[model samples]
Target: MKSFHDKVAAITGAGSGMGRELAIELAKQGCHVAISDVNENGLAETVEQLKAYSVRVTAQSLDVANREAVYAWADQVVADHGKVNLVFNNAGVALGATLEGVSYEDFEWIMNINFWGVVYGSKAFLPHLRASGDGHVINTSSVFGLFAVPGNGCYNASKFAVRGFNECLRQELELTRAPVSLTSVHPGGIKTGIAQSARMTKSLEGVLAKDEKSAKDNFDKLFITTANRAALIILKAVQGNKRRVLVGPDAKLFDVMVRMLPAAHQRLVTSAARKQAARSGV
Candidate 1:
């Protein structure tokens, strides 16, 4: 995967955010792209933006959580593009609720999109990737995967599952000397609509914020990196065939903090949460 020129990439969540930027950047590098999202309008807009580049582009209105749809899309991407070399399993959602208070419905909703979506995309695209002779799967996890925090346990669980799943996938690839590779992406907050779109329940109001609005705001404040910058970092990691990539400075810092103080880092997170709660007059 040293070169992206003339490569074909299939991306989930390309309707916006890092997924959109990754498609644009790959197109700039002369890669043909097949992008999909549940957001049909956003996919159309992304297709329009990609027109500036002289590369084949196709868009699919897809729900990655649906295994049948994901498998069908993978076949169609190969059908339209002839061959596919990369797959970015980037579709995800967030839920803000305490682990104790979060309903099975909300937990299942996030897991279906955040964790199972990655599983579906990876499993569906892998055979095609192997056929292409040069293949890579990029599964987006999160900094929360590295360390747990209060109030959003389900989000952390989803990310942690992705982290574990990809780690195993990468090892199996190496052990068998598979032509396909995997990159587990642990992104710190980037400026994305995920926070705004995140479902915040009353369970998180007094616990993490004074209200749901401030909870979303608090999530936004952690977005210290731009989506474009994060996308660039991820592309570089994929080019390097890295097993794991950290997106932002905060992610890198958190990586080290967890490594050096694996057990005690929760204390730091607890302190920060208290400060945040105080500021919100919670």
Candidate 2:
């Protein structure tokens, strides 16, 4: 869609980070925004911030992992706004652990929100979006979706799944001749609280506490983009109807690297991860 004015966008994980930024930006562009997150306090803060813009804003506490809740929220959003033009399956969590070290519980926790949440959001909002006849689904994958990191197997898996799912969803939309479009987003380390805010499994806790300095140093090197800038790029990509949007230079470079030299890229990533672990004394 070339314009967002008067359009209604439903966003998951809208309390903070890219989601919050998206809400504010869309509201500024005169679009009505329905923001949802499990963090009620954060959702309240987002609502307060969005008040400056003269647009309709709705906030709800949501746990995207809950399928019923997600579906209900989708219905409620359409009921509240009369139509839904965009659905941003942006709810996600970060988990870091080697495949061997990660627990099934932790893995499931991440998957519910990261992978299954996308599924729920897409399916729940799809019918309404089609009925609206002006719809787009924006699924948030990560640069980790493009490349695997040794200590972040859980995160990597979920993101990769999201990427694949959204791609297929896009193709299906095309076949049906639906006005709905799908876009997969791969964002490089934007300065979000994900590092400090993500749920930690025992394995992740061990690494973070024992090697906090090294972890911080490594992240400092990789985190190069801000959430606001990432949101701007994402909005532009949506307007341009891009099938895949890479947010940051790091994401773009890694996307190319994986496509051109998958094996070599894997080796490079492995080496770098090992070096970081060694430096961290982990």
Candidate 3:
């Protein structure tokens, strides 16, 4: 885990954002990479960038929500790269809706990719990682995973599930002395297209009383960290074998706030969200 030289890594959601940056950074560290994403054009672009490094690189157009596709991709990664040492279950989507406003269909859509995707990726590649004898799994959660947000019920659920699942996996691995380690990442807002690409439920507009563009702009303004910086922190976490890695100062601050004032933190978040909604003429 300390060294990535010649290691083979399989990353999901590598079409853009932190996933793409991770692939590029890993390749620079002499690691062969198998990158997958549903965005074919983005995947191709990432592949082109990775070519600057000497390490072997492969790209696959993949939907992480599809269990069959994810499993098959994992197999192919190992087959092509010879062995898999790291699995970064980083595919995730955002849903802007309250629990009452979110349809079961939309909820399921987010859950499948954000939570089940992590589960499928971890289960599919775990054996191969174990066989590699120096394996690690990094699952991406969000700051919302540490603290709930009013309009992000579905997203919070999926990310919180990822946090719990990875924590349990880490403990089980430790107990069994498994050759694999796991890290749960809680990232603060980073400069990514997730907000722009998010599915905004009608309920979100109804509740916030704001137009979609306004909401998106407000969300975008919160992105204080760049994707490349977040990727670098994640890579360092992997090298240091950290169980939980917070991507930005905001994430670290939120973690501490939630821990120190659990009940007060909820009130604070609720107040802030209400104020935001009020400002939007809710």
Candidate 4:
């Protein structure tokens, strides 16, 4: 648990960003990795990046939203690596739209990947983790999971669900005295492609942004940490057995804001958003 040497890890969304960084970092620590992502090119790129490390690495083109594929990948990780010690359910997507205007299809899509993917990964890897006798599950939630935002309803819903799910599972493991542990990661805008890859609906244009491009642009400006740094912080948390980790200074600030303001944080967020729109002349 304190070290990754010779341990095996399975990471979702290992194609790019934090997932990819985590894989590379873990490999540097001598951990064998089984990595999966929907993006074939990105997956291949990650595999290439890990070539510098001496650890065993396996790549699979996987859709975390597909329950069957996730379960199958879980088995494949065990099959390929002999045993899996960690599962990083880090695959996630973003949606920017008013809840009222968001299509059920969009809502379902984000939920499936962000929330249900964590559930499926946790369940699928748990037995393997138990068998390993030393295991951990790291679920990526978001700072949005800590507070609501107008144009991020779907993303917020999905992340909040992950937070709740990971918390309950962590507690259950403790109650059972299981050898496995869990950590919910809330990262605040680590520099990544998630913004450019996000689904930005027209509903946000007038309500929160001048246009979808500007919204994405604005979102990009919030990223204050590098994926490499985020990965290091996360691994440190896992080593310390933290049940929750907030990445970046912004994440820590947001956590304190919500803690101090609680219900009133909604008003503060709304006020900030309005001021931002005014400055951008939205």
The window of 10 residues in a row where model 2 has the poorest summed lDDT is 204-213
lDDT of each: 0.95, 0.88, 0.93, 0.94
Candidate 1, 167-190: lDDT as tens digits: 999999999999999999999989
RMSD of each: 0.7, 1.7, 0.9, 0.7
Q: Per-residue lDDT of 1-282 in model 4, one digit per residue for the tens?
A: 899999999999999999999999999999999999999999999999999999999999998888898999899999898999999999999998999999999999999999999999999999999999999999999999998888899999999999999899999999999999999999998999999999999888877889988899888999999999999999999999999999999999999999999899899899999987776668
Q: Any runs in candidate 1 off by more than 4 Å, and if so which?
A: none
* Candidate 2 lDDT tens digits, 180-273: 9999999998987777676554564455434544454556567889999999999999999999999999999998999999788889887776
Model 3, 1-282: lDDT tens per residue?
888999999999999999999999999999999999999999999999998999999889988899999999999998899999999999899988879878999999999999999999999999999999999999999998999988889999999999999999999999999999999999999999998998887888857648777677767777999999999999999999999999999999999999999889999988888888888777
- After superposition of all CA atoms, the RMSD between model 3 and the true structure is 0.9
- Give the winner by lDDT: 1
What is the clash tally of candidate 1? 0
TM-score for each predicted model, relative to the true structure: 0.99, 0.95, 0.98, 0.99
